[model samples]
Target chain A: MKKSGSAGEPRPLSLEEIAKTKGSTESETWELRLYVAGQTPRSVTAFANLKKICEEHLAGRYNIEVVDLVKHPQLAAGDQILAIPTLVRKLPQPLRKIVGDLRDTERALVGLQLRPTGTEVRE
Target chain B: MCLPNLGAESRMTKAVKNKSQEKRSLPKSLTGIQGLDEITGGGFPRGRPTLVCGSAGAGKTLLAMEFLVRGAMDYGEPGVFMAFEETAPELTQNARSLGFDLDELVKEKKIAIDFVRIERSEIDETGDYDLEGLFIRLGAAIDVIGAQRVVLDTIENLFAGLQNQGILRAELRRLFRWLKDRGVTAVITAERGEGALTRHGLEEYVSDCVILLDHRVTDQVSTRRLRVVKYRGTAHGTNEYPFLIDEDGFSVLPVTSLGLQHEVSEERISSGIPRLDTMLGGEGFYRGTTILISGTAGTGKTSMSAHFVDAACRRGERCLYFSFEESQGQLIRNMRSIGLNLDQWVKKNLLQFHSSRATFYGLEMHLAIIHKIVQEFQPKIVVLDPIGSLIQAGNKRDAHTMLIRLIDFLKQRQVTAFLTNLTSGGDALEKTDVDISSIVDSWLFVRDIELGGERNRALYVLKSRGTAHSNQLREFLLTPHGVDLLDVYVGPEGVLTGSSRLSQEEREKAADLIRQQEAERKDRELGRKREALEARISALRKEFEVEQAEAQAADGEEKKRERALAESRTAMARSRKADAADTRKVLKKR
Candidate 1:
């Protein structure tokens, strides 16, 4: 997993690394970052739901970076996280973000652009 | 509240912001505010941030909201209102009162209201931060609505919520540039500072237009005034103009509109009275000119004004009468006594009256209201019964300036204006409260000429620019038909009027009668002498004729006797025959 240590500090990733994760002559890998204040109930549910969706749909090709803002509060500025428990899709580029507890799975998937609308979720 | 250094970051972002800002070329976005559009010469600079600063309850929020709402509704440019101090529902409810259906606009995606709620107690500054979250939210809202106008109402609330002043300033500057880069015209409302324009001195950052709104109370009358402090790359009115927040929203009145470049006309309109017309060079006042009728108390000033209006209405021209001293009914009734039937004109809708107390508002507000009504009514002539009452509403200087502007405005529209002023407490005709004689193109003074224990109304043209007017004081008369002017009787004792003229006339008549009687007596004596001379001459002629006839008879008798003696002597001598022949001739002639 690739991580930014705190806000305003971006660790640049090599082009080849991004290319490989975004499926250059290989299976597509998803790079996701989840921001949270602490391991609260809502935050836990968001993380669990996100993991379940990824396991059922993108198992063995996904990486999750969990940023606990309580421990590293300065990291909030980097992603412009006004609210807690925000999920960011870093790979398959054109980075997208969604802010909520991720309770509504279908809406979250559609907002995150993981699946097209009116389609079955892959198992 | 220590602030982190954001110099380098701001510089870098500013470069990018300007690069994007250069790509767009839209110049200005119309605010759609009445008179404000004229003042700004269109509106705020487009795709740039404009600063609107004012004190609390000074209509800052209302101005900003109107900009957005009017832009969206009138100009078809969708807008987003980012309210920092008020909630979304509160804003929606507030806007509803202004006839702006914010909820419907939001539902149609024509407008988006984002309540940027920042609780001071909840937010803590841990380290360096940028307002990227706000930018993202704003960008998202704009993208959703495709807004062309944006308003950040009372952005100073961020100064309290955010603890970092340095970063906040940098971010704000960046945000403004960012809005410009996004190509959306933005209005940022800020709280007025003690001395500076904005609390945070946002004017330094906002380089396009800066408007200042002020609400001041003087003599228990609160007036809202607006002034454009700075407008880059454009000319705007710099004077303080009075504004109002009414049901339709905030309307800023650019009182004078700054210049005196109005068009002039040479067409003339009648002065209502034929004699008065004759006094005015037989052409009356210019079409787009201003006239001043100044007089003392009970000098028939109102009557003259009514005559002017009645004549205008008779000519099928619309007229407006703004009465400050009397109500509409009272004025109509008063005019009726002088044979001016104004009710018929009112019924025909060619004449309208707007009566109000001069103390109803401040002078600027009064000017604004007048301007607004004039625009709506579009009358050919406007009459202010006593413009002096307006002087009581404000200072002399302001009233004078207001008068000049009013005259300039009317002249620009080519509407002839007649303003009546009461010359207070003075014998001469120069006791005007506001010296507006210089602005008026024509001035007619009506005065009371008291002579022989009777006051008489006299009218004269004081000055008529661009025309030669009669320099005579005519005896002004108000007959049942209308106002009339009689030639002032100028006998040996100077100008006479009223009872003095009548008495002078009576004295002249008596003198004329005495002169006539003396001339008739002398004519009779001369006729008697002519008769006596004729009688004597006739008697002398008769006596001479009788004497001549007697002399001829006596000569005839002598000749006859001589002829008899000659006849007797003829017996003795033949020589007597010749004498006897002469005697015979004389006797034959007798």
Candidate 2:
């Protein structure tokens, strides 16, 4: 889903969406930020897994931003990140966090609230 | 994996090299916490991680925070606090009560706090992940302040936040090594586990130093104790020391640090009562000596302590009076009745009263408070009114040990300590519940001598070390003026006191008067007998004088009769001639 902007340039679009949403209008844009530490294997896998999930479920309404904490460690304090490869749902009310490589798709879906909890999402 | 192993190898070599270079002892980082440095033989090992493990509410976080705050404020060492349990704002607020302005310190760029919020419910683990984010945050915080000290308070929260224990444990080991590689002295706090030093056995990784803090409640009183379990490459105090957390922050009382090598002062101080002073070697208690005044209730223990404090204050010496039984107002008012204006001394700041219930805190807390106040006030004299009250706060052995430490502390400072003990009525007067009698320099026993339907107080110096003291018991009196020690009546009936002594003195006075009257009567009778004998001898001499006069008159008459007969016979001229010759011869002889 590349509706808002490219994944590499999601900050400005998300800021604009947040400012607009402060008014009475609610936006349908899904803003997701993934926190990682450098180019580790888990970070790469989590990014790949997240991209696949977003393209499959929220095809045209999602934006993915990758925050490498090694380069910008101060950004970790914003989302209270302790584990690497933490996926934070920045927008879409009730912020959620999913940690790890996101290798298990069903669990990731349940964590991000894309699928209801306790539902067995078989392939 | 290869890179991490190489890093570990390099760190191991560096540690070895460091050990070789400093073969004597590990370089230390001064915690600046009072009494902690002394117990640690300096402080925590430098550039190494020290695990401070304790149960919940045992002051682990405060201790670690103080380490950082003191490091920044006092030692000029910038520190970074990576808190896993408390937020930065919470820590700052909590430290504010201890007089540490953490926010100000942070504004000065001397301290940096990073809270690693780990909520297990919010995060779902899908696959393998390392705590690289936490490492990055901590490193960034450390680099921002160029910190020489770091604190990871309760870093074990990662276990709950992450699913893989293998990764978390490995990462923690690496983190400790990394902290060492960064050459920053670090304090890591952990929760105590069952039969283990920490809940996660974090002590296994950070092995340079491990301190165990315990908060134990005995008899409904809680005491906080700290013990240095292991300090590698250096000797440390092995005893469980009592620590206090108050407005001044954390202070560990290194009780046994004082040895018996205190300099003894030969100077003597008054016991307040002049007679009592005279009883104690004609001077008073030796300066720097511990004096125990043990007595039953109402035997004037507090009154005696008040007199001591009064005397010390009158001498212009600062006196610290710790009254465990009475409040400050009550003590002052009561001393006023004894004609001692303690309020004046208090107003002049020469006397300070620290009154509290004996059960208000554990014995250790009381000891710590005593230590703190003694250090701050620097009093020349310390008075613990009825120290036996403290025995109720702790076991007899604990109270004994605390008293020994206290006595040693006071003796080292050459502070004359006056300790009053309340002996129960049934127990022997010579026995003290705390069993601190042996170490005391002087022991004064006051007891209630019940006799002749009256209860009276008597005092005697049981023992006075290095000074000759009175062995006789004196009747203790709490008069309107002050304490008075009167000589108890020691007669055929044993030691008598109070009104009985007064009555006995009166009875002895009457007996003395009767004895004087009997002697006067006997002297009068002997004078009369001498006068009668003199009269009888004079009468006898008068009778002998009358008899001599009668004999002389009879001889004269006989001579006249003889002359008349001779004249009648007159014719005989021969008789006349013979008489004339005889008369002439007799006249010549006369």
Candidate 3:
């Protein structure tokens, strides 16, 4: 899949490549925008789950940008957010949006085309 | 640094005067209604695009115009109305009927109303163009009139006329930003979508606030409800509040104030139909209260409403009767048989009849007419006979908006109203009866029962807001004398179903018991009569036996005569057989 963000702006990196990119990273490269509206329960859950996922999955390689419409409504223009609780792959080519809470790991993994957690070494 | 202390106190005093009529603890807003700024906390988010999306005929344009006109009148702020669809003359005329006097306002340099005419087929776009022309004209108008409020009578047309999808989208984004920057409260009327709240998708992720207007009918009762779907950085009433549009202007009825807090009366007045009043409890509903009488077809819905109007006139209260089902004369003639004399009320101007067919037009057009009449007449009570008839014209929801507005208009004036609705089945005791029960405070159900080979008209109070109404269903009769409320008939088997089956069962059971008792008495009496007859038969038998014995004893002389005759014959036979004695006997016999 073609990603839109800076680290993978030209092409989506495979799990093995992502692991190598993490090894060769100079600074936090990925810029992600979790677009949400207010402190509604679903939005809050999505925000919390996204932060945890970024911390666990990308470690210090990604910079998570939380764009709350409650604070800055104008930021909804970045990735053309429509419904609330949208997770946008901003730094990846062919920007993708996954709506609803990010707690559904299987759907998120498929949407972002992330490699299975323990199978990265096999690739 | 601001330093204005001189006229501020007097301004506060004027504001206090305006505050008396407002609902308690309302946020600082104008609420976009005429004479309503004193009620809302403040005008709706100033300079931000407020989306007014509801089902059709929901008083959206009227509300927007009210905001503009009220801004010009109450606050002396100039207003500009830019309609993308209607002509300036038509828009002005529409406002005029509501006492806006747009032409006069234009002369006073207080309002600039323009209808931006755009031909969709003739327009072509080659490159991205800034809508600076519209902005420049709007800016010039604002400068000329110092306009504070602006309304775009539906932004959907702008998208319709311009073919440059990319530019239009960008321009719309720019347009909303410009309105915000200009700091003038902008109302953008958007057509509702078949699926979405707004068709153009602009209402998605609104900038500031979104108020949805819904017009709907439940069980034939139409109601228009205004609901604040989204309001950023503010708290608003989430429920859909009822509203009205008329010659004066559109007014949103704050349904939450239907408590002891508002002015009300405890005095009961007849519903013009005595039967209806008793259903409301004892005499009837209190004056200045809304009454809804609903029932299925042929249940006397119109007659009951006519009867109510007749009673109101007799009580010296002016009433306006709005019949959407039948003509005035037709209504009068039909109700005459039920004893409701509306001619006298019409003569005294106590009752004014307004009848029009429901298919005349859409719900908005009907609401507009209703608003005009209520504004002109200002009657003490208003009546909408068979509100459901309008549903045949459009969706149930559209009919509802017109209803809410009508009810709201009367309630705001403190004029009591009697609305009639025709239900599906003529069942008065339904589990959830009367569709408009939510909008109305009181509900009366009228029905007819086939009782004992005769039909009985009955009425009962389903619900009455803020009143101690009886749950008892009272018997009612309509005759040439007028509407009479009959006393409650408590029969042995409880409140009888309006059917002949109950009486038939009683009759059948009584007949059966009577026949059983008569049969048993006949059985006992016949048994005694048979014993006497048996004894008489035994005596006759004994008498017959004694007669037989006497006959036997008396048979001796008759037997001896017979034997002598036989001996003579035998002697003759012997003579015929050729003996000398026999020959003589044969000659004697010959």
DockQ leader: 2
RMSD of candidate 3 to the truth, in angstroms, is 26.6
**Per-residue lDDT of candidate 1, residues B1-590 (tens digit):** 00111233233334433433454533678899887876676688888888898899999898999899889888999998988888778998888887788888888787888776554432333323456557766777787779999999877887887666887888788888899899999998988998998888765456588999998887665678999898776655666778987677777876454345468887888988998888888978888889999999888888988989999999999999999999999999989998889999999999999999888888877887888888888999999989989877887777787787788678778899999999877445765678888768899998888887789988889899988899999999888888889988897799999878878889999999999999999999999999999999999999999999999999999999987875666654555455667656754775
- Give residue B135's error in model 1 in angstroms: 2.3
Candidate 3 wrongly placed segments (more than 4 Å): A1-123, B1-42, B49-70, B80-103, B112-140, B151-178, B188-206, B210-229, B237-264, B271-285, B288-308, B334-340, B356-378, B382-479, B483-590
Models sorted by lDDT, best on top: 2, 1, 3
- Highest lDDT: give the candidate number: 2
Question: Candidate 3's residue-wise lDDT over B50-144, tens digit each?
Answer: 77776668778888888888788777877888887786689888888888788888889888876664443222222123454456556556666
RMSD, model 2, all Cα superposed?
Answer: 8.4
lDDT of 2 at B162: 75
Q: Kindly give the stretch of ten consecutive residues in candidate 2 chain A with the minimal lDDT sum.
A: A1-10
Q: DockQ, per-model, please?
A: 0.03, 0.42, 0.01
Off by over 4 Å in 1: A1-123, B1-26, B96-99, B121-130, B219-221, B258-260, B562-590
Residue B406's C-alpha lDDT in candidate 1?
Answer: 81
Pull out the clashing pairs in model 1: none
Backbone clash pairs for candidate 2 read none
